[model samples]
Target: MTRRHTTRSSVPRTAVRVLLGAAMTWAGISHLTVAREEFRAQVPEFVPLDPDVTVLASGVAEISLGAALVLLVRRQATVGWVAAVFFTAIFPGNIAQWMHHRDGFGLDTDTKRFVRLLFQPVLIAVALWATNALRSRR
Candidate 1:
């Protein structure tokens, strides 16, 4: 079998990926700095490690994943898959926060928290679409 090469993806694809990457980078920065303690409120109570550890580790993961998404253009599909998985993985924390009524990032109202919950899947879809990971099995 011969290997296929992709020089560059479409402008829209690149834009979406870059935007998502930048958002993640910003979030990771907040996680490690000013919003560190606030981020802990989103950690699920069942997580075995301290909430701070979870927040910090997730911050690192976000930064790494974000950078990968931004830089790994040749492997867009792979990066998208990882980013989607990461989004899926952290969804529970969002759920826990919503369910527990933990306030952060101005999501003080229950309605706001619930509305935010709906965006998680959208992020996953954007990740896949931006990286061309969403494909038909033709």
Candidate 2:
């Protein structure tokens, strides 16, 4: 017997896509300006790149991913994969920050630092799932 396929709706998918896209876009902008210094402080010493360059590159990458997420939301499966991959790509920076345990960037404490690290993966999963939902309908 063949299983039935369900048609996907675009309304919910568009809503989620817009939200994640706008949020990440804003986050990328913040990293480039308002939070640049804070991000600079999070760079790991062993990353083998200049702090300024790293921050700038990261901000650009973030903005690009955010744009992609927005544009590709309708292609849920593809966007899910892309977002998941992007999230994994940035894991190192989080690990570096947690391991280094430095202060003065603007974080309240080491606990906050580590907590933020833990949240990255979760955000990725959400992005992936939201995108996937959008894709399923198409």
Candidate 3:
């Protein structure tokens, strides 16, 4: 009989991953509900889709990705990579929000919006690290 060995992430990584997932899920719900208008501020004018539609679609995406992160323990690395890519893909919206000085989610000031931009990379890194995507398997 052949046995398969599975690797588990450290406690801190697991905690972070779960927390990130929960946060994403909550944000997704907000996008579809109370924070719909706030989320619209993040959609760039150049985007082909309407701002509301974009926000809704991204919300669905976030919900799915967030669920995957929490449920797909065996595929954490893959989920992490996907989450990182999603963060990268949405980065332009952050830039647009900052440049246009859109007021949403308490990011009224340019400094606040610009400062918020700095956190995207950190989220990407956290997703990767929490999923063990940044580690090499021996």
Candidate 4:
């Protein structure tokens, strides 16, 4: 069996990747289980589907993206790009939460919810950085 090479330069990137991957996994689980209702609270009322189904689908996507980040080193850039897009796609949910003044999972106040919405961009940056997608091309 062949082992994947670990470059010294990638240590920090790898750590961030692991954190992103774990976050996705945790969010995925929350969507499916303990925090499912909380996730539903984030669903934009404009979206037509039953909130449960949307939550389930998003949960599955999170798990898949999370697994890809953790397992597909060779495809990290692609995973990262997808991760970025995934976070972008979900931004509306954050917006909805803020607009509706919904509360859940430690974001029990309008200020907390608004502040939480700001973190989506940070997550995107972390994804890109973790995959080195933002590094200068050789």
Local lDDT at 44 for model 2: 75
Instruction: Give Cα-based local distance difference scores for all models.
Output: 0.91, 0.74, 0.93, 0.90
Candidate 2 Cα deviation (angstroms), residue 72? 2.8
The C-alpha stretches of model 2 lying farther than 4 A from their native spots are: 1-13, 104-106, 133-138
**What range of 10 consecutive residues in model 3 has the weakest lDDT sum?**
4-13
lDDT of 4 by residue, 1-138 (tens): 998888997999998898889889888988999989889988999889998999999999999999889999888988999999999999999999889888877888899998998899999999998998777333
What RMSD does model 4 have? Answer: 2.6
Top model number, TM-score: 3
**What TM-score would each prediction reach against the true structure?**
0.90, 0.77, 0.92, 0.91
Span of ten consecutive residues with least summed lDDT in model 1: 129-138
**For residues 1-138, what per-residue lDDT tens digits would candidate 3 score against the true structure?**
989654564878889999999999899989899999999999999999989999999999999989988999989999999999999999999999999999999999999999999999999999999988978442
**Model 4 residue 108 lDDT?**
85
TM-score: the better of candidates 1 and 2 = 1
Clashes of each: 0, 2, 0, 0
Ranking by TM-score: 3, 4, 1, 2
For model 1, name the residue pairs that clash: none
Candidates sorted by lDDT, descending order?
A: 3, 1, 4, 2
Q: How much does each candidate deviate from the true structure in C-alpha RMSD?
A: 2.9, 4.8, 2.3, 2.6
